[model samples]
Target: MEPSEDTSAVSPVTPPPGCPLHSNAVPLYGEALAEDDTERWERLRKRFGGLAPVKVEPEVAAWLILGYEEHRQILRDPHLFTHDGRISRELLEGRLRPEHGTYPLVNYRPNALHNDGAEHQRLRTALVDSFEKLTSTRVRAAIEDLANDLIDAFAADGKADLIGQYATWIPLLTLNRMFGQEDRHGYFLCELMVKLWNGEGAEAGAADQAMVEYLTRLISDKRRRPGPDITSWLIAHPAELSDEEVTQQILLLIAAAHDPTTHLIGNTLRLLLTNMDLRFSLAASVIQIEEALDVTLWQDPPFKTLIGRYATRDTTVAGYQIRRGDMLIPGFAAGNNDPILRDADGNPPHAQRPVSRAHLSWGLGPHSCPARGIAYQIAATSIATVSARLPDIQLAVDPGELRRRPSPSINGLVELPVTFAPQQPLARPHRAEPAPPAPPAPPAPTETVERPRTIGGIWDRVSGAVRAWFGV
Candidate 1:
């Protein structure tokens, strides 16, 4: 597909009446966007230069920035391209209807993701400072312990779904630890988050409410009794955060950190298993998982699209006139494969792209992901842990048989089935009761742990054992 700027790549489908979009707009959210995204990106780029107009919903139109330089321009300039959606033109003009089910997404909140200027600085600094306190050496040790324990729960079975048993748990368990909660809360919160994201009908809504209530309670408890955790750090920050503000930050951090980090680990695992060069090197212990992680971030970013960065005012980007309130999304995956970074045929330079460090997956500017530093640590640690524990692991099914999760927003597999050499399960963490104040109590009772009899409940048993650390 030779690059063209003919402006004739209009879709056959038409936008609804009163839709404030261009004539050539195409649907941005669809199976095509997720399934054959590279092809769709190429087709759209050939006609629309680096930025293409797209219909977000049937009635809403927005710009999809697909060029590397275009991404830098939009992401780096806060004055022109702000993160705040409250000042959006469609919104102010009454085009963004409340019943459309997306108003809440665009509505302004006090969190860092939705704010600008000093407020963003304060909130982001609190997060950065908190993370800095968690030195990499300490963080890695904790993650290594968590990964090893999780592996112990299922390694004896000889086979397991990496996604269900491993990849998915690291982020949730880590979040609970960071928030200074016990294993029980992680189990409770993990179930709630899973239901919130994957449950059906009223189940999703109920789970969301329950999670909010739980977090609120956790924050209140932390205020009364501070601990050496992220929540306590936020609560005691110089910013003097209110309970609601702390709650907002926790919600933002968790939502931003969990899925992306989980998928990053999962994708990296898939690459190391399927790519022969990396596979051989990994088996020989000569390959750094960070390189594999970089490749995954460039090729299969955790998030395919970050929708709705609105124009603060009328502006021209890449020679196109922009209207105030027009929405734009920084196409991270597309920008990583922009023509400038690609060959004359518009294919990414496979030999060089992975080694190059220009991917926008972590984003840019003030609104960039605050959790990026720890995300790398968690993903690399998780991958390293798996490789160390299951050196001979191989895919249970053909690579092509692996299925993606059904969401255009995320690039992740539904499950990763693998087989490895069975090993003796490690001793689970156990809790012991304390002595009485009056007299030496009958030797403090030790709690006995019951391992799951079947592999089906490995996640619950292993993850539930985290309570031993907190004495909960």
Candidate 2:
């Protein structure tokens, strides 16, 4: 269906000044909506009802799906509410330009997150197959080991910014290991991920381009020397994906992995440290870290709102008219706390809620997160490891003083300042040096070699080549 040209379908009510949905207001993409999301969502719900039209960019307005059922309906039926939208088309047609101050969100590329039909299925299958290697047992062990290593770094410091030192590093390290990346490239990927998340237009685009180039090199190397890693697995998959396809898949995987996992770890930790009821439940063994993770997912998912699902045709959702080409966002956080799903006191009725994972935190439908189990394992294990080691860990500052990072795509803490009792670093095994090679068999009996050559010349050449190859 062609896009509707009718503007009257949108609410004619004039928004008051400073309202996010107001036509004259600045685009709401930063800390304002994310910092205090609960109150802000409530206000938006009250003002605009469920399907509210809000500005994602200065001149771009989209309907934010705030109702629980409405959100689910949109997700369930991709035919009516599809992921393919005008922004993506514009991006493909080279009509979308990136300014230094603009967010590079709608610069769509063909990946699982931005596609539909058979193409999405193909890309998603490759991604799912790659992640299948990360079994729950393996993920738990790796996360636990990485978490402890991070803790060991600051265990004796008595105070540490858990967000910076622990939550942030754990996922990055784990992903790097899974991708078979050295520490240098892993750190570089982390830097670029942050730049893409927080930087604007030119900077963000450059970071993304750099990531593609880096991943291309990484994929090329993996092709030459396949290893027991995700990248190698992708390269060897029966799909026979080209270099660009493999690079895009890996880029999407990395992008999806880092932000959500980091925030999941951070948000779950925040709950455990600050929510006394949750802490007591954990201490009494009434609830596991996984339950706390569920609560956090339900209450404060990492991404408050998702981007760019345009209506395939003119339709009405929850009493609001959705014209074709109108952008629709699934308010995952808001929908999770929709009034219809909550009790009279405005809280989730835990007892009456369905046993199924109904929360939109990991999203819904065919486009839902594929690596959610691994994500959960990473988060749960990280929290458990920290709790076991730092039994007395507490927030260093008042809860209200903490700030959320400014981004439309994420709801994460800027820093989680935490204090715990100082303790000795855990002991780790030392690497054993290789035994000297039997003096080269006494220079072979038949060879009457001259004794004038320098002793370390051959070793130097070998070490230099190794260092050069590995970029060490």
Candidate 3:
């Protein structure tokens, strides 16, 4: 490493006083790791400090990074702590495999999110350049329109499950628009995702293969005829990404970007319905949409833990023995709650929650999420549209009854049932005069690059849970 920092201080291999033995390591997915449960996290931290040994799956061990500085140190050094999962000892030893639930997450993939160094730059550049082509105004307009369309579907009903009816549909349709695919295509893909996430054994595997075919068709079309969509932009970018790279990035967008943003909306909505102060502030114009969303992210973000970060060499972090192939899972929830990063007095509810504060909800360092702006645009517009249309909406069930999804795939409430005075939907006037012609679509990709002789194809690792619990 460069100059060793205080955060990198290692203790004797004999082990720290309170460190739990490997056989007694805590469970990363257990109840204590719940997003809002600070007491449990505190207890775990008191015993294990920043680097807490935990079992990711049955018999699969890893360390959950709980200290903010320790987490930051690891993420900042990419060469030492890599995103690529191929070097994982568990996978190499056959303790983890593609068939396991955690495999799809930590398994090696040829995408920007899972690579490092110059290779990562090439793959990541393709995504950044493509995203840079989007116009904020255009994106916001699309999100607002899509939001209204989804709201209009259930506005006449006195009650609705916001999660199923609103949160899920917004991301699905918005992503479809971004991908330059038809609404029918997104709906079909969503059906397959649901099957893949919910189906088990051969059924889940079958659904996974179907998703592969669906995306393959999409990529093939873009290759033949370029368009304004992200898919087309990637093909035309200077990075010279292969067809497989383009597909993986798109899959990552759908899996990583879609679910968290969906859940952020759900989490914000839950606060609005349950927290009186937030609702009052939002209705009274005391806080903007961005502030409201920020509150949720700080307190109950879209995920409890970020993806796996593997060690490139054997090292010790806070007295935890980290082998060359050892994996460190960023504890998003725990890191956000790290007292060192927060006020000594402690965090308050959403009403008093600070805005624009640092948080690990989107991960950290060079590998942090690149789609924060787009994700916020879609989520903010979706929440605003519903609030405007149904100002009187209130939670139908007791706030205590809202349950967190126990699945490893999601991070927010199970459902958000709400009731409102039946309201008239927005009306559009029809006239004999036709509307002005629509603007032209993005020009076909003019940037030239050599195509790979062999365009690799693979299955998408997006589990069915995104479909079942489509929110964060």
Candidate 4:
């Protein structure tokens, strides 16, 4: 461990003396819809004084790392900053006496978010294989078929909400296709995902529980009658895992795959529509799709906030004095936007000629996301297919009208409205010559005023209220 620096002599910006335990909760970037102004991220940089301290729970504190070089270093050095919340959980749950003692729901540990070393490697390896199976060629081809079918239905209408019709459809249907899992559970999982990532949960405790219940049932059915699906694979290899462990991993996998892809698709639509020049550029150069994806991820990653380790021993990060047990957050959001690290003019770092400014979308070092390649490939191919097939797509609704889930962790629109000219792939237009004819112009029609009906207002309200109350 590195020796601790003197906190006393370092640049001192005293925190409020005695605020509420969670007062300095440190609103993450993009938490507040208004403050998400990306323009201000540079201004906020000066306030860090090398380290920005934040409160997670009322008493649980963590440092938000923003400096590009230091953030890179912390992510690389796994020894000093530990991801295993088992240590922190013991403190919060009063499990210091026994590691497995029950406490608040927050005290419980999940699969491998907080693990390191060989255990971490094992968990990650399993997940990598799972993802490979998830995004295989056969699975992608199935997704392509689904996308084409959905497009065919909407082409006749000339207008449809992209999120409602396509973006949401692809991911949900892809998940269903890959796992052969059903959304017979309704949009419950999607809604839960939006809430969990957004960190807006009165039922955060019950969120994972709900997933656990669903996955448990899924794993059980698969075990009884296995197939060539992901859940079946998990059942086939239960040697290193118990039934419950298998269930938990599946739940985690489903959640990870669902939200990230949803946001990636959603964000891609928003970016493409807003930047028409970039959109046209991409449409023109099909081969440039990969670079476009790299740029999109660098500019705006789907998940902006992620949890990380607390220092196990005295350590220095970004030249700030960090004591043992101080929580550290590797801010993916902040890192991607760091002006000193990226070109403010908006040139994405090329993979072939990688510079110091590569986006930390998949993260860095040991715990980096293993499924990034799959995510990129899936997102890229989906967009490429659309661009090649329908180059004239545009927003159906006003750009400002689309709403993003007001969550800091996940950044994607709740609804995205889009429109495009309808055309059948197999049908071709025929040209014909027309003869001109002389005719008088018709007079314009007069506008008519409609009478208001007031008697039915109460009846309509009562009926609407009843339907809402009963959730009809």
Best by TM-score: 3
- Tally clashes: model 4: 2
TM-scores of the candidates are: 0.83, 0.80, 0.84, 0.72
lDDT (C-alpha) at residue 354 in model 1: 41
Off by over 4 Å in 1: 1-20, 31-35, 98-102, 283-286, 343-350, 428-472
lDDT scores of the candidates, listed in order: 0.72, 0.68, 0.72, 0.56
Predicted candidate 1 versus true structure: per-residue lDDT over 1-472, tens digit per residue: 1221222232233434654355667876544445477888888889888998886655556889999999999999888887888776556555554444344556566678877788889988888888877778877876877787678778889998998878877887777788887655666766776665555557765665566557766776787789999999999999987776777788787767667888999998998889988778656756567767888888888887776688878888877888877888888878888878876666664345346556889998888788888898999999888888888999999999998765445778889999999997655454232111121111211332222222111111122112111111
lDDT of 4 by residue, 107-214 (tens): 223354546777667666666666666636776676665566556656777777766666655664566555656433324555444333333234543554444444
lDDT of 2 at 279: 91
Compose the digit string of candidate 2's lDDT tens values, residues 286-309. 877777888888887888787757
RMSD of each predicted structure: 11.0, 12.0, 7.4, 15.2
Specify the poorest-scoring 10-residue window by lDDT in model 2.
452-461
Cα misplacement distance, residue 416 of candidate 1 (Å): 1.1
How high is the lDDT of residue 354 in model 3?
A: 51
Instruction: Give per-residue CA lDDT, model 3, range 1-472, as digits (tens).
Output: 1211221122313323453434657765545345555675677799889888777666567788888888888888898899888787666656665445576667666788888898889998888888888899878877777676666667778899998777866786677778888655665665565556567668777767666666666777787888898989988888887787888888888876556877999999998888898789888888888898888887788887765898999887888667887778887777877777645566443334457556777778889888888888888989988888888999999998988776443677767999999876566453232211221222243454443443322333444433332322
After superposition, candidate 2 runs with Cα above 4 Å error:
1-35, 86-97, 100-103, 195-210, 344-346, 349-356, 430-472
